[model samples]
Target: MTIEVNNESGLEIDERAVLDIARYALARMRIHPLSELSVIAVDIPAMEQLHLQWMDLPGPTDVMSFPMDELRPPSRDDEEPPPGLLGDIVLCPQVARTQGAEAPTAHSMDTELQLLTVHGVLHLLGYDHEEPDERTEMFGLQKAIVDGWRTEQGLEGPSPAPTMT
Candidate 1:
C-alpha cells in the first residue's frame, strides 16, 4: 500500500519513520498493496476548524478522517487494487503535544497519531466508534494494532490498557 504522509504541521519529522508505522499498521489489517492512504499533519487552527465543522465541537481534536468510500464499496475486480485510494487522515501535532502533557512526551504523541491512522483506515473499512459497543470494538482493535506495532519496533511504553467504556 502507498501511504502518503503530508507534513502540513510546519514541524520537522522523519517521514520515513511515520510511513513505516503506517505500513506496519496496514499490514496488520491485511490491507493489500496498491491501496493508497493519505495522512496529513496540521496545526491547531486547522484542526480546531475541522473539528468544529465536521463534528460540531468547539475544541481541537487529535485526528479527523474523511473516508472516500464513505458509503460505496469498491467493485469486486477493483477491490484487488494496485491503486485504490482509501481516504484522508488529518492529524494535529499541536493538539497531540497538548495531549502529551497528560503522559510522556514522545510516547503520547506518536502513539495517538499512529492510533488515529489505524482508526482512519478502519473508518475506511466502515468501522464506526460512535456507540458504546462500537467504541469498545473499534478502540480494542486500535489498541491492538498500536501495541503490535510497538512490540515489533521494540518501543518502550505501557501497552494501552483496554477500556470498556
Candidate 2:
C-alpha cells in the first residue's frame, strides 16, 4: 500500500508509528496491498476549520476521515479488494494529547494517536459507530485491532477505547 503521512500539527509527533499502525490496520482488515492512503496531522486551527466545514461542528476533533474510493474490508473468505484511493485521515495531536490526558488510563499521546489511526482506517473501510449496534461493533473491532497491533509490536496492551459521540 502507498501510505503517505504529512505532519503539520506543529507538535513533534511520531509519524512512523502513525504510518505503521495505519498500515497494520489496513493489512489486518484485508485491504488491497496496492491501495493508497494519506494521513495528515494538522494543527488545532486547521482541524477546527475542517471540523466546522466538513461536519458543521465547532471544535477540533481528534480525528476525521474523508474516504475517497469508499473501500471496504473484505471478508476472510472473500478475494482481496481492488486497489484504489482509500482516502485521507486527518489527526489533531493537540486534541489527542488533551483527550489522552483526560482518559481514565491516562494514555500517552502516541498510544492515542495509534488508536485513532486504526479508528480512522476503519472508517475508510466502511465501519461506523452511528447507532448502538454499530458503535459496539466498530469500537470492539477498533480495540481488537489496536490491541493486537500493540501486542505484536512488543508494547503494552491498549488503553480503553475511545467512545464516539
Q: After best superposition, candidate 2 residue 127: deviation in angstroms?
A: 0.9
Q: lDDT score of model 2?
A: 0.89
Q: What is residue 89's positional error in candidate 2, in angstroms?
A: 0.2
TM-score of 1: 0.80
**How many clashes show up per model?**
1, 0
- Write model 1 residue lDDT over 3-56, tens digit each, in one string: 889989986555665677778866666666667788899988898999999999
Model 1's alpha-carbon lDDT is 0.70
Local distance difference test values of all predictions, in order? 0.70, 0.89
Tens-place lDDT digits, model 2, residues 1-165:
999999998999999999998999998888889999999999999999999999999988999999999988776665757889999999999999988888888887878898899999999899999999999999999988888888888996564668346
- What does candidate 2 score on TM? 0.96
